[model samples]
Target chain A: MEVMIMKRAIGVLDSGVGGLTVVKELMRQLPKEEIIYIGDTERCPYGPRPHDEIEAYTWELIEFLLSKNVKMIVIACNTATAVVLKEARKRLNIPVIGVIDPGARAAVKGTRNKHIGVIGTKMTIESNSYETALRHVAGEIDVYSLACPPFVPLVEAGELDGERVRAIVAETIRPLQSSEMDTLILGCTHYPLLAPVIQDVVGPDVHLISSGDETALEVAAILDFKELENDLDTVPAHQFYATGDVVIFDRLATEWLGQPVRAEKVEVSGVDA
Target chain B: MEVMIMKRAIGVLDSGVGGLTVVKELMRQLPKEEIIYIGDTERCPYGPRPHDEIEAYTWELIEFLLSKNVKMIVIACNTATAVVLKEARKRLNIPVIGVIDPGARAAVKGTRNKHIGVIGTKMTIESNSYETALRHVAGEIDVYSLACPPFVPLVEAGELDGERVRAIVAETIRPLQSSEMDTLILGCTHYPLLAPVIQDVVGPDVHLISSGDETALEVAAILDFKELENDLDTVPAHQFYATGDVVIFDRLATEWLGQPVRAEKVEVSGVDA
Candidate 1:
């Protein structure tokens, strides 16, 4: 009998260590498939960056992943996903995904009052990516968007839980308390690391939608629909890269992922755009 | 300014009123898209029928929906989906969806122990569709499938909640209790109507993966990816058809859907297979 080799890995890129939330879920949800992830921790918060700058950085990451011969690409950063998702899909041969849409879809399904809340980086909220995405597939939705800038920094520092985190979450999330939103989309990837704190602040009645978790489900759906899933029997070797502090990323990856992962440093400028 | 015309409706077919569960979700999640649903309530339980007969009946339903000029199609009946899904995709021009994969994907996502339980019609369980779909995406998954042949009749009889239904569900779902499955997929489309009882039987720790709700989310994701979603300003004009007892189907549709809907009768033989 002839042998059938395994297919190519899926490429995932993000602004920083946040995308590991997506990676963890992918590992759990689609264990057979291999994944390659790159986080630009050096230029970490893509949220405050200009549109052109964000797209240019995103395209470079795409090219590097393309060179690795990935079968599909997932823009795991909500900020970048909002800025460059449409263009990347048009430019690339592979199917490209955004974190925004999956969370939006899940929020639509989970909500009973059609009232949704979104908390993300300033750029993600200002771009109205969650609102646009939520309204694109769903109709007549009441969207309440808030920008939570401190959440990412907390995760990057490997500070997931404590009184400090809870106090910050309670104060920051207080604005949306009166919205009466039943489903809150954690629009930023790093937000999931603080999900328990966020969920606590939002109360038990409100469901928190994690972009990382929901995107993993969407990735599985796309693979099945496109017939691009890997049917390999070999153990998957997941690769992780960070542009800034590999030490910090490595520690957080191991801690958050519940597995040991060594992150390598990569210079974003060295990759061909 | 140029106006954009609305897209065509999505065609959905099932073995009987069980598929209305899917329709209810589609309405809730995707309020913009028009839906055309047909149920072969005459030959209601496709679960007991041979594969060849299921395919023939499904093809006739597909042809009727095609005549209405739908943009996409969904096989809402788990039994028919398992039998006809692959062949139908190969023959159809538009994207065709099945109820099994979505539930399988969700179960894989929701399960914490990598152990899952599936409860479906006899044919769906016997076909090993859930196991196939689950293992196809994720590796090393333990799936326990039970053929709850009595559950469908309970839903069809419109006896959703009562002590009698609770006793039947508790008895039928007892096999899965020993499986140590963290996620239990209601593999039959009709199962969602009976979800409260099933959940009570299985307990709260086990996450119930409703095929109808999951498929609705998948439908939204596919629509966004394919750009087949409707962007019309007009309210959707939904249509319902049944090959058997229109009155019974109509009553179930309105009651389960929580909306007043009139189902029309059609002769399945008149439609070309």
Candidate 2:
């Protein structure tokens, strides 16, 4: 008799429900691959935390996924990716991808007027990762970045479409309207859910680049190149983990993924320095 | 002291100047990496040919690029990709990507109502590659395919805009007007150059997916994953080869790429069984 082993799953980590946007994309792009996602909702919004603390929490999430025998790691949160991507890539033997470079590359290619705008959390904007990556590809392009701290909170509260959310989005984007930017990068994973309002404000001329969609394309290509793709004929089940209330996490995942999702609450300990 | 050698260039092949669309994308996404493109203009319009003949001619182009030591291959022509992508991937050691999957994946994701349409050459539409690829991702989505043979000639003749091009586009796309497809795939590389007129005919509600842009994203990801990316500080030079008139090829390349191009005419013999 011959024995068969289950294929390893792709691991994804984020501070909260924001990374679900990326998960939705992965499911669409690579339907056969199994996924294991962790949301650190117990300490949600790693955006406002100190760099060292955010790094420690991200590592803890990585360790948990490693225990689950994940074949790859995707840092879907902008704050975590900007802070710990280099260190994670160095320490992990498997492939590690961050959302920043893919998004940056798309924005650079999508822009025609050499002017690009980026909107993200305070940590991501302050880090200036997008500017560095974009300038690295094209030396003379202009980059404009703004910090929208309230946008993430609005998304987590499930205020995606309404007058209040639209007003907030318009007010936050009012400053960039006259900047004459031909491309805009939604730096945070949570931002895609709010894309319609953002698109309405920016008008149709300015292209909106979503980090999740770009990242998913990168993931599919990497898997094919590395030969790590799941080729089994069996349909794989996806697993979701949260460090806080399972009910809330399940509700958000179900709504965003357009399917019934059950998330389990797991306590993750901090990693040592 | 250790001396570093230059990295191999990315190889791109097309039946004619149509593949410049893909080259334009690669330059934007991977600016540091060198590229070597081959356009078999002496045997242009492979759409109406038999599958076996198209495969043989495509291999001859591949052999020429292999002699140049390319790190990867991109089948930029829709008819060739539909017939030879699998065998090419099997025979080549490096990664091989086709335009069909990327365009199909984008169309699947871009559609909100689960209805999509594909436009390509007669051979490509008859191959049913897009329908198979799209259904592999989503089981119940609707796919409509149409063959527009006259579109390519208009592009090669530099009739990209004006009332004449718009009228031709409207007439060619009239068959799919009642299909209720929310997303349309420009399955052929030449179609993107005519996007303005196509968009005008399709109206504002329908989204257009460009295979060149999507394939470039996949190429960048694979290069990063395989660690085959050129990290040198030297400026990369691109090389162009044609099997037909160098003057005509040079004119089209320079006009489309917005840069001065010098094409070398080379004779490529068909492969024998």
Candidate 3:
């Protein structure tokens, strides 16, 4: 029972495996803390989904995580975050965090040219959440945003490397080449996995801000501030859950996490209560 | 009267103008927010002071800031923060931010080599706060710490340029020369003003993490997270206060802050009922 009390994991919700980047960072930054991740991979890519449906799915993920008695809630998916984060923050009792704000703050601080480029899914870009977060930090900041529709699908499919993928990435992000942005924000969590290719296209001059790394740091800050850190020094057996095929989820989870992981298949239909 | 509610400035307290680095970053990051800075310049170097005395002076600064009804409190001084931040965060009603944790988290995340260097006042280095913070973030990390007593006094005297200061900085930080720390946390907020010189000494390969920039980013994160941001769009009339000579404080403030300003003298004897 004492061990159970110390085992309440940080609940992480994402549309799919893209949030692995955040998980990777969270593990690296706060190694002692346990994480329970819920990936709504059945309805993967919440970007094109309607706002109402997105919110419902997000709540389902939140509810599942909460049932396990999570200490905090992290909206690791940009599309889900853009849709449900504000409402979830108000509605939930636990401290709620989103990927957008951290990335925004980082881009604002890291940019030398005062001009930033952001690439995300259609919903994330259309929401203009990054622009809002960036402008909220510094008024004089210039933001250039693009929605890379093919990017997420490519990541989810594990088409992350090779000349074909590089060509696709180049053509997809070709519009922002002339924007003269010194800093580029990997607004979508999935983008980091494709970073080597993206860096190849964008060149070394443009700094890439990973939302996962930034958000993980923010989580550490909030945990410390709130005095909600799990004090157990013992390593935790981290858990991963998926709403779709368990085999693929496990494979990718193991690959991205750089460790062996077994993903449990979960049904995220409607709310339990 | 409506404007009065929104005009509550972020109260920033430093031993002296060393924290002006934090204030400068805060203003740049959160431009719309009002700021009220109090520099305890009379007892400028809080490094050599006793713990009990430092705590008392910190409380005095907090009381003065509270009297003005500050929206947030930032302990921008390294020595004071090393001594008083934990207690202040627990005692204060509003959010209280410190310079150390932000730098710690940034260093942990920024370091690829896992070997980091930290430089600060004697008191801050003695506290081993950075080691505690760095170890807290990730285990099996190497940390090299040094106390450069002259850096603060040099910064206070505005010896920010030329070969003399550079030689002093190089000689002072000479102990950590071959440590091979890829990331260096300018653990003292005063250190950033001497960055060019420090960068020359440490070499460009060593990434210097300024507490001010990282702390400013944390302040923004906390403000947005806690819903403590000031919403007014119009410019705010920022105020400056000094416990000692207003002339030197005003001059240094203007030089470091890049704006002309006047500093008012204030007495912080004891707590007000």
i-RMSD per candidate, Å? 0.9, 2.7, 1.2
Better of 2 and 3 by DockQ: 3
Best by lDDT: 3
Sorted by DockQ, highest first, which candidate order results?
Answer: 1, 3, 2
* Comparing 1 and 3 on DockQ, the stronger one: 1
What would the per-residue lDDT of candidate 2 be over residues A133-181, giving only the tens digit for each residue? 8876666688889988779889888889889898999999888888989
Candidate 1: tens digits of C-alpha lDDT, residues A1-273 = 112224689999998878889999998898888899998888867777777788899888888889888889999998788888888877777889999899999999999999999998887898888898888778689999999878877876778899999999899998999998999999888888788988888889999899888999999999888878888888889998888889888888898889899988888774233
lDDT of 2 at B96: 89
- Candidate with top DockQ is 1
Model 3: lDDT of residue B25: 88
List model 1's recovered fraction of native interface contacts, to 2 decimals: 0.92
Lowest lDDT block of 10, candidate 3 chain A: A264-273
Report DockQ per prediction, comma-separated: 0.84, 0.41, 0.72
Off by over 4 Å in 1: A1-6, A270-273, B1-6, B270-273
Give Cα distance to truth, residue B6, candidate 3, Å: 4.3
* B-chain TM-score, candidate 1: 0.95
Clashes of each: 0, 0, 0
Candidate 3 or 2, higher lDDT? 3
Name the lDDT of candidate 3: 0.89
Q: Which structure is stronger by DockQ: 1 or 2?
A: 1
